[model samples]
Target: MRERGFRLIRLLEYAGLLVVLIATLAAAGQEIALMYRQGRVTVADLLMLFIYLELLAMNGIYWRAGRLPVRMPLYIAIVAMARHLTLETPDMNAWTTLAEGGTVLLLSLAVLVVRYGHIRLPYRDEDPDNIGGRRS
Candidate 1:
């Protein structure tokens, strides 16, 4: 029936997600090893590694719960922006640094907002009309 087909598609999607997560981790590990061997652990390198790890973790968490929380990626973005600013040379304009720094602050706020929602206002309704606590 259609239900079975839908389930099969979901299974396939989950499999693909797993593969993508594994590949990301593998690539991140390779990059980390290269950085280590080269005796270089710059801010940019660390940020890239952290982003990769966060993505892989997010994928795993989603696979388990059939949901992806918004906070993880927001935190990752904040870290990435910080790294971008840190790696920039002194000659970079003040405005550029301030813009990137402001972005990081916004991302941090987003993460905090999402976390507060999940913790302070846990979703309890299961009605289809209120899917994920949103009007459908």
Candidate 2:
């Protein structure tokens, strides 16, 4: 009975993942429509779209591999910061831009560190199903 319950849970998880993936696709389509309506695509808009794409890709990768790498979101963060700079170009007070850029740099370093740690210390026995994914 316990095994059957576990299987049922997995099935439910798969269903949920599918729904999310479909929503991601739908969102992408909406973004395209929005871009068309806007007449001109700015750097910030492009970066925002890139972030969305990365998020969808990450979700897919995690569903398949049971794990998500740190680098993907780090890349997204860098893009997001740049996007912010572009979006706020007219209103930027040097100090705020500096702070945001600094934060991006820090997150970039964190991505490198996380990559190194993962490579040096691969997933261990504590990993559920040995897939290097969420523990629960």
Candidate 3:
């Protein structure tokens, strides 16, 4: 019964992942269509597409390995902040711009720190294919 319950949970997780992947792809398609209608692609549009790609990649990694790297969401956050700055700069006050930029900078620093830690202090039972660092 426990095993069956675990299997059911895993199935639900996979179904949820499938829904997210499909939604992300559909959003990307809509964004592309909007770009076509506007007849111009700006930096903000590209950044938005990048966010979509990162999300898809994150989903793919989790689906394949059953784990997610800590850095993935940080990268997404950095890109998202940058996108927000680009989209809002015109109407935002100088202080607001500075604050947003600082947030992105902090996120970038976080990514660097996370990468450095992964490289400099890896887990004792690290698996190249697994992010969970589970011992076998």
Please state every model's RMSD to the true fold in angstroms: 2.9, 3.7, 3.5
| Predicted candidate 1 versus true structure: per-residue lDDT over 1-136, tens digit per residue | 8668768988998998989888997999899899989997877887888889888888988888777778877877877787777778475898887877788888888888888899998867454345556664
Per-residue lDDT for 1-136 in model 2, tens only?
8678768987888888788788878887888888899888777668878977887988888787765677887888888888888888679888998998898889889988998998998866443354545565
What are the TM-scores, per candidate, against the unseen true structure? 0.79, 0.77, 0.85
Candidate 2: clashing pairs of residues: none
The lDDT for every candidate, in the order shown, is 0.80, 0.80, 0.91
Clashes of 2: 0
Clashes of each: 0, 0, 0
Q: Quote the RMSD, in angstroms, for model 1.
A: 2.9
Error of 1 at 118 (Å): 2.0
lDDT of 1: 0.80
Worst 10 residues of 2 by lDDT: 125-134
Which candidate number maximizes TM-score?
A: 3
